[model samples]
Target: MRSNRDRAILALAVSTAARASELLGLRGADLDWGDQLAQVRRKGSGAQQWLPASAESFVWLRLYLEDLGPLGPDAPVWWTLRRRERSGDVLERRPLTYDALRAVLRRANTALGTNWTMHDLRHTSALRMVRSQRLSLRDVQVVLGHAHLTTTQIYLVEDDQEILRRVHQYLADQAEPSQEAVASESTVGYDSNDLAVLLGGVPR
Candidate 1:
């Protein structure tokens, strides 16, 4: 909602599904304004790939950048809102360090009453893409910058809650009166003996 630099960074993280380290390394020249693509350097292989970011992400990015003037090619895309006096006496617009990002998330967790990690943000991105059914798994792997397809396949695992929901629905269907029950008027219904095992019931 807010267009602060932190929100811009989060928007890019969720939309692009880039790793926190990869995003932290973003420079002014890395973003393609016309295409809404961000060039990220992979952590393991050091391969450079362009990730498609959402239009809304770029809008927040632009608004965040408006606070700071134009940046040179090598200037970091993300910057700290306030300079820490503990760091040094001289004032400077420092790049958003990994520690600072963690601190931001810590504050967010406090307010949300939930613990969330950067990896969870990536998981959310992957799930959103998979459920949308617009993009293929391979497409997601490319954006996520995963070296192995197997690593990308982790997102395909079914959620436990979904599994439990289906199980409950199946039990409910079985418990309901079936078409056969209506036709025969439960003529084949089990007696108290079967009910004893199932429902612990017996007629006097």
Candidate 2:
């Protein structure tokens, strides 16, 4: 994505797994740089919480904001790059709206030849967290703000393709002998009598 704003938005979405509305509602003051946490407004409850984000996301966010020049802490975090017509028949910098965000994704989907939506980003984030195994399901549940742990357990379901890959890898591993074992085995020639004894026959 050439648009730094879109890049920042995408980075934050996958890293934080925050709802689109939560991300859109972020103000310039919402970030805690020291902890690398972001304050996002949770959907439904309208409550706000801190979300841990990737450092790369912060890099993109800083770049996007730097391009916009200085903004007050209370200024909306996301803004339209192109000046838009506002009330009083004047063109002014406007906060990035949901429609504009959709347009951004539409353009990206067109260029990438993929049909994806903002909600997909949240799914992607959750899957990544679950598969990484660095975070527990409970942690993921908290991050996703699920009312019950069972909601996060949905990710525990194995994907068909992933199961296939793991099975193939295991079969391949089983088919091979450990090099250490092979190296430790005796390679000396055995006499015929010794071979017969080993084969459960009388030594002859």
Candidate 3:
């Protein structure tokens, strides 16, 4: 986890949820560098867009690239290198495969002792948009890259917690008596028998 470059790439992937291909396609020029918002073109997308970076992510990405010198616009943003393994084995400098991404995720998850799948990050993002930020389905649709609004709507939920919170708040807000109602009730006070009749109940 202390390997700065790998960690930075992991955080970037988790935060953005962009396809691995799209992410690998990124270049130094694609990033604002100062603001850290990255402009990404999806692999099959006709549109290009910006992704805001977390401050921590921005910091690490800069740190990782600082000594690498100038990376050309078309160069792989996440380049692989033949580095000695923990056991002193050397590997090839090929572009990282999708399998490598999954392996990294698995190792990270094990170290953290969490059951997180690579795709789960996307679901987590959608859930956060709905629950934490209260973003609209349309906003989520664009964010999650869902072509259809209905597909995005699947992330919005009327789950038990949301339902219960709404019900409790509504009841609490209604519980306080209005001054006019209280005064009217006082003026119309009646005997116990009258009260019982008005309530449609016989006296106990």
Candidate 4:
């Protein structure tokens, strides 16, 4: 079974498409419970952006936070578990680092026999949003915090099968007559050669 912390991490990664650094930099105060959104600082741009958490993510995140007990607004949303200095047997908390986050994902993937990096989760999120057809490219660009629409276009690569299906459908629609009356009515005694000519070609 997956731990609550793991679930929360995966959910946020796939839901927000946030960078590893942004995820690691998240603070308790950045989360807006009322809006179900988290504010993050984008890399390079250094601009603040807001990402909405899915309902499932919110549930897991809540569970993980509850396990942390009371924390100040400045405390890290995700913390590392460390051994206590005095008890040695007891575990203490510290800020989560990129390496620590990577280790957590690696451990989770070991049982599943998969090799996925943190950035892959971002790409997965982008593809899912595009395939869903619910949001426009502009909307996806905004959600992903991409500065250029061209960059967002790169994320919308379609499957070959899907492309073929759409092309076939478009051709079929274009070839279809507006009314049945527009079609030729002299098919009573048409030969194979004549049918081939009408259809442009015969199947080999």
- Which candidate leads in TM-score? 2
- Order the numbered candidates by TM-score, best leading: 2, 4, 1, 3
lDDT of 1 by residue, 125-186 (tens): 99888666688988888778777889988888787997799899999988997887787986
lDDT of 3 by residue, 32-99 (tens): 87777777786666468777656777777877787455677766666556566674577655566667
TM-score (C-alpha, index-matched) for candidate 1: 0.74
| lDDT (Cα, tens digit) per residue for candidate 4, span 48-113 | 888987888888989988887876798888886888888999987888888888888788689789
| Most accurate candidate by lDDT | 2
Inter-residue clash pairs, candidate 1: none
Worst 10 residues of 1 by lDDT: 195-204
Clashes of 1: 0
Candidate 2 stretches with Cα past 4 Å from truth are: 81-90, 177-204
**Cα lDDT of model 2 overall?**
0.88
TM values, all candidates: 0.74, 0.80, 0.68, 0.76
Q: Please provide, for model 2 over 1-204, each residue's C-alpha lDDT reduced to its tens digit, 9 standing for 90 to 100.
A: 767888999999999999899999998789888888889889999888999999989989889888989978888889985644465555578899999999989998999999888899999999989887588888999999898998898878678999899999999988997787687675557788988988999887
Compared with the true structure, model 3 gives a TM-score of 0.68
